[model samples]
Target: MKPSETVLEIDLKALEHNYRYLASKVDDNVKKLAVIKAFAYGSDSVALAKKLESLGVDYFAVAYTQEGIDLRNGGITQPILVLHPQSTHFQEIIDQCLTPSIYSEFVLNHFIASAEANQQKNYPIHLKLNTGLNRLGFDPKEVPMIVEKLKQTSSIKVDGIFSHFAASEDVKEKEFTHHQMDTFKKVSDQLIENLGYRPLRHLCNTSGILNYPEAHLDMVRTGIGLYGYGNSKEVDQQLIPIGTLKTIISQIHNIKKGESVGYNRMFNASKDTKTATLPLGHADGINRIYGKQNTNVSIHGNLAPIIGNVCMDMIMVDITGIDCEEGDEVILFGKDKSAEVFAHNAGTISYELITSISQRVKRKIIP
Candidate 1:
């Protein structure tokens, strides 16, 4: 409630709804793992994870060791999987009872050594097989060796095996997704057979859970969808966005024709118009791309186009001929039809749009 400060409202009911919907997609054989990484994709991880925990999420997934530690520090009892494991934090990881996704032999060996040094026994670790993303995880050829290495470690436990799908919403490119699933399954089978371990096998993400029933092996990790941002237009239509970014219109002014606004004179009023500057800009996670073509806001339920380069703490929207005044409500992003719509206008994804929202914006859970 300070000037230039912003607030984001998260709907817990909508989050619960998204979870139940994704859960409905899972076959009876598959468990649900809620992806609470990146601060629940920038929407208060602790609050959201606590809610998902209460909603019966079978597991929790984070991108790093620190994220898992944050959840543990917050008193989360559900199993937390760190999708990306760092060798340096293996000690804290073991000390905190965090489950890490072991990808490379180097990191795996380090984890093994750390576990042994700490006198750990049967510590659970997830195996990530790199099917296609090429970003992280082990190659299929390395699975057998990984299995062999794991068998040599007494203090570590291979609790789960999984992979990430690059594309699942594009029904037209089902081949790519199918290939990823098939490859992951083959590697997982090889790993388990070679090591004689069957911990828990999982491969589907949010989009993957909706489109590929067979890929939901053992557990399904729901991230954006759990936060109510389905990747595709069709799937996105099925759910309500849970977060809404709002700020006050700090001031309004009339700019004559040819008058410039904001920095660099990037936007000029083509016609005499009324503009309102709201307390949100790139500094608050409204990316600069939303400045011209992608910017739009809701005022009195009517959408207005953004008129200038987004300043550090403010943006100008043409409210020409609209009823507006200072201290009025302005929806910068989230549940407002404008934000997601603007993302498409800027040729970007909803995850970038929502998660990019700055933490300075007070995030509150709506009961």
Candidate 2:
């Protein structure tokens, strides 16, 4: 059935396929932690998380405390790691049973204080190490201080230690990635020696899982992979894009040569032109960069170039010589017209493009 309005259709079967394909990359014993932050990369997080939970994924991760809370409220019972936690939300995090990633001295100290005040024992917390990402996590030199602080508190226990990859997908940066892996290994060994136990050590993002299998330590974390993007043309073939952005043609016009269309008259018909207006624009997710023939939408398997400046709520496309009409279904991006191709046309990446879709846009889940 064709959707009457603009919708981001999320395919659960494609999601499951991506998950199982990624699962096949690692051994059965290595735990899989699915990253469902930013509303599951702007596709429904709760729904995707629920589906992954049923698939027996070992863990889930979110970018903030509230995201983890949302998962919990949505009835997700899996262990969720708050990747970038703030000091102010310590109590709320504890109240919601969300494990936090202690990335620095400030977070580590604040979390310990919060846990102690609440009289919580062995509250699980993950230590994030700075392994060249330099975005977050404690530096390698801070390991001694970190271990000392842990000895001083029973309120919080290090349940896991992980790091982020700066560029695991780039083969040119393979040397740097190996350096990060070596650093993480050194830090983990030191921590285990001092703490007398080993926590789950994971350093793989989606690319790392596919490119460097040896780095798949006790557990592996995957974000974009589960959502159907593998960061490269070759690996992308092995995955399936789970979200499809679609809309309907709202109106059509037949204009003579020299007639202008859309805001600013950016598009003037050089010849008799057939134009179609779509019910989506920059306000939805299609950035203005995609306008002026930068990208094309699929109408009845034919291509129609976006013909003018993108407006707040609409965009006009040149359907000249194409078989299309008002109320006809349009494929903005999907399996046939991939989001990667759509984003590439506008000089962007899939992550930014897909995640940029406004929350106001309706979401429809499919089999």
Candidate 3:
């Protein structure tokens, strides 16, 4: 396959390694749900899901129903959980055999009605309780009401119950995280007692898996961590980043002192400097804020500070004093230059940095 000027290289071996490493952290009975939402966080969902499914991933998750549809179309047979399914897509969800995380009374009832209308029997569904995040899911106090409604519905079946942690990654929020766990347990217990059976219970996300092993209930869902980041320096060292963004130097120029480079004169060379322009910019996931002293790219194992405003499809970097020339491989983020570090320099998180990579960028899987 021909390489594009800019490419997002996905190392399948590293991805599989990260999955095994994370799986090792959990109990044998606990299932693993690989979160492949946002196109596997912009790493090609179908390919990643296929690999994970083959590796014995018990389940997969996506943020939307369409993503689950895409997976189904891609020949993915593993169970898929739709995190935030809407009422409009309930029929299609059932048709595609995609389970939904029903959060609200309205969503639950609507889904039940849809199932009944379709003459569906024991259609799998997951209940999302709002322990503390408050983004989605039913409030803990609503468990009794939810239980009553489930009793009335014979069309849908509760396959699992879960909640999201707002700050499981922050040690400072330990108290809050525990409170969420406690609330989830209480709510899940009530539901189980009322239903006379227990559904699969899960609450831990990526950080929750590493920080709170005790909270890895019946199953754990991980998105960012599976892609080779542990949300912190200590754990990150144990994981290998599976995705590497690389590009080649398109052109090089020798800038004389006092000469400006790139748009709006954001960079004015004080001394003669060598500048290299890379075929990557904001449109390619390199945010404009990373330009003009904010971020640097790795070239020949050295730092090449990005100079001037990052353009839509190009960025100029100061390559002075570096042994580099046109066509040299430049690493935006990978082994030598961590995505976490690059995102930190741009005042964001690795999630945003990696997921922001444009779909137009070619993705090559390294077998």
Candidate 4:
């Protein structure tokens, strides 16, 4: 295979393993919804969704309607849930058969009006309850009003009801997590009692799946976990990271003591040092904060400390005593260092690091 300057290698086998691993955590009856938002967390959404579709994933979700449309255009025929649908996209959502997650009275009414105006019948949608996240979702007190509004319209159907967990991974916040679950249950039960039937109810994200099995409810949504992270050491050990960020050393420089490297002269060679310049930087999602001797990249199984401010298009790493030349492979965050570890060194989380990878970077699938 030909090489690229910077590439994200996605291991399909590892992705499948992660899906199955998360699947194994819940009961057979519980459906798994693959959250592929943010381009599958900066992998390839269409490609990843295609893989998951073949694996019999019960449902797929994206953060917006356009992402769902992208999947549809990419030949994904499975049911898609739009987690945060907008009023203007109702027509497209209906035209494409994408289910919207209606969270507010304004959104709910706008969608109902759109459905009625289009003369659509039983259009499917998911209801999002606030349940303490408070980012989006209908308030619990509005449940009855929402149900009544739905009853008045033959144009829309509630296929599911769900909520986001504020912090299911934090053991110290166990009580708060349970409280959110309880609130979801109360709100969902009230809707069911009024509507005379229960839509699918889900409340667990990836962390919730690992920590709160009982709260899995009717279905579970797996996002970061499906990309091979468990948010903790023990759980992460059981999962395989699917994406590997790699690049090649563009050049090597032998600098004498007192010589500076990269912008702002942040790194000065105290001793005669050999440095390797890599073709990756802030533009490729290597955050600026990761520079100034804050992060390291692995070359030839050895850790090479970053020596200066990460540039817009390149970075210099101290490669002294390491037998590496230009064109040698350098692993930014992959099997050697792991995204979690790399992100931690930068004072951030793996999710931010992975999703921040520039779209210009090439993505290759490993079969």
Candidate 5:
């Protein structure tokens, strides 16, 4: 309740609302896969996943097998997809009924053996073809051969063919984006024609959903957009921000013109100022790069600039001439400032900011 000993509040209703908003964006033919990986973008995946399960989310996606297991343990019966699964967890995956994105031959073989050993007949799997991002997914040249090999397997089933869009939000780069889309379509066609048939054929992230409706063939995997950050600034303006991150000012200090605050005296008061120190720092996922440039805290609904270097467990904000004192509430990030703003300061995206948040911060599920 106080600023210094702050708690990060998560609105489950807001989470549900955001889910429904993105769900509304999808055509009836397309199923929405809620991306809850990385602790649901550092907002507590277990709790959010439960609420999402109640909301009838068509599917859930996690980055690894462990996250998927945690959801299953928490009683999430909805289909869960592991985007970055390990071969060691192949048996566990079959036991838990988890879907995995097959990217390469190594993963395919492990999954095939695990399925066969477990007598898993037609266990659903998604084929991730590398369009152009080249971060993950199977190369285009490997699709035909991989399909032929999977035909030999008895238990494994190809459920979907998917890929990622690197820059669907940038309309100026439409040519390059379309090129990737074209390549993906061609490879997907080849896989389906050669392999016989697959259930779902998708190639859309949030931005792609808004830009190219044709890409939404079967299902869509959405991460940041569902959490209310948006595909990009321009597109998200219409969407309500669902996450509100708050902290508190622990102490207030008045400094003379020459007095300094924070580590190594990085910030010396050029004029008489009232600075408020927040019990939040890079340790809480507020990266140090947020200091000095484009970084500030919201105090009493007003923006307070962060001064000096952000400490490991605290940050100092210039709250001069504002009606504020110790134990006042501060907004590190939330609906008001937006996570994108914080990402902009850190030279990253909201997805990274949320995923990178440390586990030390206390997350409070709020109304």
Candidate 6:
């Protein structure tokens, strides 16, 4: 029997399956860094990190310093790379033994000062290269200046040099992707020569690991793939989505023709209709875009279209022909019920859908 309340079931077995599948694609020599940022893409980050640690994952990464601190508090002893560290939390980062990705000259200088003030020597840091992302990273032309600063500071050491792909998943952007890769390699090589030592080189993201095998380098970072999405239908087949969102029909309503339902009468019944109300709504991450029959939920193995405007805590689905009643199990997205499909119907993606799941929803981990 399914739980009465809205619940997100995180399946560890499926997570392991996805991990093993991705690991199989890489060589034994290359290290695998699991991207656990955004609460592991909106699933339990600490829980998932611990599981990946036990599986011998080489490293873990998070977006912010607090996220890394949370993992440390949760007993994740694995090395965590704070992808976007702020100057204010530099001391906390060092105290917690978390590595910071030094992206720009400002970040680099600030981290050095913090490490020195703490009397730390040879603190590990990763240099972020721009490589066409145009987001956060040092331009390739800045390699000389970056190395000069590194020489002046003994407080921090270059542990790794990495960059993000602009579009590894799209074959149409192959030229741009390769240019990014080549630029990373050239800049990395230049930095290595200037520093007189080779740090770990990692540039491939999830799609890069699959599409551009040669660029796997010394390590690869994967986020979406680990959560069972390959960014494409063909690749997604080889992965298993780990999070299953389920809820129950809170109430059922029968309306006659010419009756209207929900806020502002957004859904008007032209014929007699039966509707099932679910406990989850936009507050739980089912965006308002999914309402008005844009998507559906699985009830009694029947697809029921969501009707009317989605409320803050509820959504009504048309279940006129479905064999379901109040309190019946509702599968929002899981197993054969694809989250990708659910998100695409509303001009979104699984990453947003899964990560947007409100923390208030009950989480049940299937170990």
- Assess candidate 4 and give its lDDT: 0.93
lDDT of 6 by residue, 1-367 (tens): 7677999999999999999999999999999999999889988998999899999899999999999999999999988999999999998999999999999999988999999999989999999999998999998888888988888878999999999999999999999999998899899999998998889999998999999999999999999999999999998999999999999999999989999999999999999999989998999999899999999999878999999999999999999988877888999998788899999988889989999999998888899
lDDT per model vs. reference? 0.83, 0.93, 0.92, 0.93, 0.82, 0.93
Give all TM-scores, in the order shown. Answer: 0.96, 0.98, 0.98, 0.98, 0.95, 0.99
Q: Write the per-residue lDDT of candidate 5 for residues 87-189, one digit (tens) a residue.
A: 9998888889999999998989888888888888899998988888888989888976797878898798888888888898888978988998899889888
For candidate 6, the TM-score is 0.99
Better of 1 and 6 by lDDT: 6
Error of 6 at 306 (Å): 1.1
Model 4 CA deviation exceeding 4 Å by range: 1-4
Q: What's the candidate order when arranged by decreasing TM-score?
A: 6, 2, 4, 3, 1, 5
Off by over 4 Å in 2: none
- In model 4, state the lDDT of residue 342: 88
- Where is the poorest 10-residue window by lDDT in model 2? 317-326
What does candidate 2 score in Cα RMSD to the true structure? 1.0
Task: Give the residue spans of candidate 5 off by over 4 A.
Answer: 1-4
Mark the 10 consecutive residues where model 4 has the least summed lDDT.
Answer: 1-10
Report the C-alpha lDDT of model 1 over 24-49, residue by residue, as the tens digit.
88776678898888889888899988
Candidate 4, residues 99-120, lDDT tens digits: the string is 9999999999999999999999
The residue-level lDDT of candidate 1 at 86 comes to: 80
Clashes by residue pair, model 6: none
Error of 1 at 257 (Å): 1.5
Task: Judging by TM-score against the true structure, name the best candidate.
Answer: 6
Candidate 3 residue 48 C-alpha distance from true site, Å: 0.8
- Over 33-120, each residue of candidate 3 has an lDDT whose tens digit, in order, gives 9999999998999999999999999999999999999999999999999999999999899899999999999998899999999999
